[model samples]
Target chain A: MAENPMEQFEVFKIGPSLLLNGTNVSLTNSSLFMIISVFLIILFFALGTRKLNIIPGKIQVLNELVFDFISKMINDTAGLDAKPYFSFILTLFLFILSLNMVGLFPYSFTVTSQIIVTFALATIIFIGVTIVGFIKNGVGFLKIFVPSGIPVFLLPLIIVIEIISYLSRPISLSVRLFANMLAGHTMLKVFGGFVVALGIYVGWLPLSFSIALIALEILVAFLQAYVFAVLSCIYLNDALHMHH
Target chain B: MKKILVVALFLLSISQGTYAKEGMPQLNPEFWIAQIFWLIITFFLLFFLIQKFFTPKILFTIEQRKNLISNLIKDSEDYKNKISVLENEYNQIITQAKKQAIDESLLLKVELNKRINEKKKKLADQLNIETEKVEKEIDDFKKKTLDNLPEIAGNFSTEIIEKIIGAKPNASNLKAIISEITDQEKKSRYV
Candidate 1:
């Protein structure tokens, strides 16, 4: 009745394929959307800063609201030490949120649904956080793997588990975002197909359901972005403060 | 915008079959390199722009607002303290004025009482002198009137005797006789 729903996930080059050391570095739909998200962020902040109001205009208020939210989140989760990295976390959040929102447009590519993109972002954060830990605590950062109150026999087991979980951070972070975006968009595509298959008279049912799913997907987009940033803050807290 | 959307859809339709033959296009490793490449580029770009351009001004504005609020609170507290001090000074002045007024009124009352008493004593003395003069005058009037009464009676009796006898009687002898008779009457009636 409608085109294959999976066809929407297809990635294709938009321009001439550029071989960078025999690697396909050509721009794709995913890249185009990514660039769009970046420009949108630039445009939004540009508008926010243009007026420079004491009593903020709507855009500036929105800018401040986002800043204050992430600021408070970092402050609450990681304490004062996390304050310095507020802009980085804020940037990460806005980037993901922009990508998510842009993807919701019809016939638009969702960059976040790609596992490699999410994984790459998560890997950068994981590597950065690890380096920070080493910088702050030196060899003592290794103690993050060992349980303090465990018996001697359980130490080895606990250390292995901790190391595994520690290594899994990037995977988990990446998968969480990638999976949520993939599932939501996939469901939307499927329901959109269902509306087409059901004909004009019976199509209203699936159409309404797709509308509802769209609302939920929007919520998920915001939520996943929040989670990604907050988790990063927590990881930083562990690295910087190391309460236990 | 719609043109862009239509173009994008047309592109997707034309290019779909190449990747659509697979199980999952996301799992295909062919396109991962481009996606990750752009992700890194765009992510860092956004991060750089927001950090460089917007944050400092916003933070400065927020900090200034905080300082203004705290200063306003401090000023109000200072004003409250000043008002209390002024109120205390005003209360002290009012109490002092009230005490002075009460003291002045008491002094005025005492002075008025003294003046009234002096006037009362002077008026009583004046009334006593006037009363004494009036008593003396009354005494003189009574003496003069009583003395004249005997002579008047002697003359009246001589006239009575001359009329009865058709001739004048001896005036000196009659006066002496009348005097003796009046004297006896005075002793019996006036004394």
Candidate 2:
């Protein structure tokens, strides 16, 4: 029988444990997958952009498409002030997307399946966006919770809800990605286990379902990354404009 | 062989230890530090690579292509303007040349007519002057010839008479007769 479906999420130390400042900063399976994603992203971008041309090939087209997609997304969502953060957003999108894809392969570990990784990213964006908001608007940044045209009687209630939503940004962002990756990968493992246990006669059934799930998972992966990046752009837009 | 067996047993126990954990290993606080730490490192590494290298080249290429297109369009527009200006100048030159040619032709016709009329008048005047001189000379020659004709005729008549009769007739009588005959000839012939 195949190992437990949950075993896929285990983080095993791949090398000698190292303690940095009394904390265990040892390299593990999760770290290995993260590094692999980084390498893959570098390889993809490097390979596609190596030869610049007026007319592009297949890979170059894909490279430009991704860049333009995020570029236009930022411009549409966050306007031109978001132009400066194009690199950060592009990196974030590529990193998440590549990590998601790399995890789809057999025997590969999904980095985004871990809550800590996604939460870390989301917290960083959330914190950075808040700082930017405060910097751009000063004390007026708090006015985002106080919407216009509301009756003074409802202002207090509206502000509470708005504040709650604003505070939940990082949690929702992190959980959305982490849950989706974890659930999809777990489901795939569970079904894969079913296929093996059922053997040749009925194996094809679960096997086909898993295959279909993979296709859906791939779409989910790309979508989650897009959602992640777009939401960040929206947050940035709010900070810079303080209105939308 | 004993060492290898012990190592395998140790590895199995370690793997078993993780599987024994409750709920999600993701919720486990133990691995959170390493995962977050590595994620930051790799995320920044990816960010550094892309920001430092990729986007600039792609942006430059795209911007260059856009500039090339816009420049070509601008150049074409400039050339189009130049073409229209040249066409206008050519048309103006043609019209100007045509106007000049018409003016010169009209002027030439006027000058030629003036010269012809002048030549006609000069010829008529010269002809009138020649005719008047010729008529005056004829009148003078007629008067002189008439004046000389009577004397020569009287002398010739006397010589003839002297030869016929052996002497001239009476002189005063001949004078009277010749004078009377000359007067009569002048009146008859001149009148």
Candidate 3:
């Protein structure tokens, strides 16, 4: 019988834990790696910006690159008033990007590869946008549900449609990233398996394909992170401006 | 919301077994737990670094650039004012120099004319005095010569009369003597 592809994804317990109703809440390999990723990201930025020189060293250069990139993104999409939100947006982008890239390592789990993880991120963004909308506009936040220029008779249906569209922001945002990462990784694993199954001569083809897919996956990882950030900015803009 | 429905439908479609092969990985609870924990940690750390270091430095640099530009602008304005003032002062100096030169030339011309006229008058007065003195001398010589002219003429006439009387005549002498006597008598009577 063929081995179960789902077997590679199982989370095994790694530490002793308190049992609540016979089930133990224990740390898993996935959790351990995630903690490590967080630590590494912290260490990187901490060391990167310690000097804060006018002419940046290698680490500071990288730090400034990220800073300028995110600042520009916010300024462009969200307007100058949104400068305050630059830190949050930049943090989101880096965290998601690092998590995605970390997942590509051998035997490492892609947190973004799972729907739950992406959904949590998307939900947070959704709540944030909603809060900002209400906070900025007060009772006028409902105006975002109904676009201007629709006829009176069609208004009800249009408003419903608009509301539905607005609510789907998180769903779309999360799924786009999650689906891309999951599909790309699965394809890589499949092709990688083919390299072993097919003997040496034909194996080279699948091996090469796997290599190419790996590179493509890395690109997709970065792209998805950027898309997520940009979309968030656009949503924030709608909230701030009450644009339909 | 329509968008939410669309996402639900999309998720529903992808939930099918077609995309999930027999050997494909399944979503487990541990993955979710790890992602949530790491996401929070990473987010806070990133936020702190941005807030503490990056933001302050960028703002400080921007402020410094603004101050530098303002200072340069002020300096340029001060320079322009100084230049204009210098130009005005230079023009004033040139005008004063020209005025002084014209005044000096006019004074010199007037002084020269006065000196020339004075010298001409002095020379005319000296020439008039000399001419008068020479004319007076000539007049004096002429008067003396005129006075002596009668005595010289009397001597010359007496000598001629003596010679004429010696050369000619007895009868005429007698008659002349008689006549002389008569003429003398008559002249005396007449006188």
TM-score of predicted chain B versus true chain B for each candidate:
0.51, 0.38, 0.43
Candidate 1 structure quality by residue, lDDT tens digits, B1-191: 43344335434644664344554576667888878877888888888877887788778767777798899999999999999999999999999999999999999999999999999999999999999999999889878867997788877887888899988888888888888987898789878
DockQ of each: 0.27, 0.26, 0.14
Model 3: clashing residue pairs? A5-B23, A164-B1, A164-B2, A164-B3, A168-B3, A168-B4
lDDT of 2 at A193: 94
Residues B31-90, candidate 3: write the lDDT tens digits: 455546545555676668767766677556445656878899999999999999999999
* Span of ten consecutive residues with least summed lDDT in model 2 chain A: A1-10
lDDT-superior candidate, 1 or 3: 1
Q: Quote the positional error of residue A166 for candidate 1 in Å.
A: 1.2
lDDT tens digits by residue: candidate 3, A143-185: 8877788889999999888888988899889988877877777
Q: Which DockQ-derived CAPRI band holds candidate 1?
A: acceptable
Q: Please give, as one word, the docking class of candidate 3.
A: incorrect
On TM-score, the stronger of 2 and 3 is: 2
lDDT of 3 at B138: 93
Order the candidate numbers by DockQ, best to worst.
1, 2, 3
Give the per-residue lDDT digits (tens) of candidate 2, residues B26-78.
66678788788888888988888888889898888788878988999999999
Q: In candidate 2, which residue ranges exceed 4 Å CA deviation?
A: A150-156, B1-20, B79-191
The residue-by-residue lDDT of candidate 1 on A106-179, one tens digit each, is 98988888878889999999999999999999999999998688899999999999999999999889878887
Q: Judging by DockQ against the true structure, name the best candidate.
A: 1
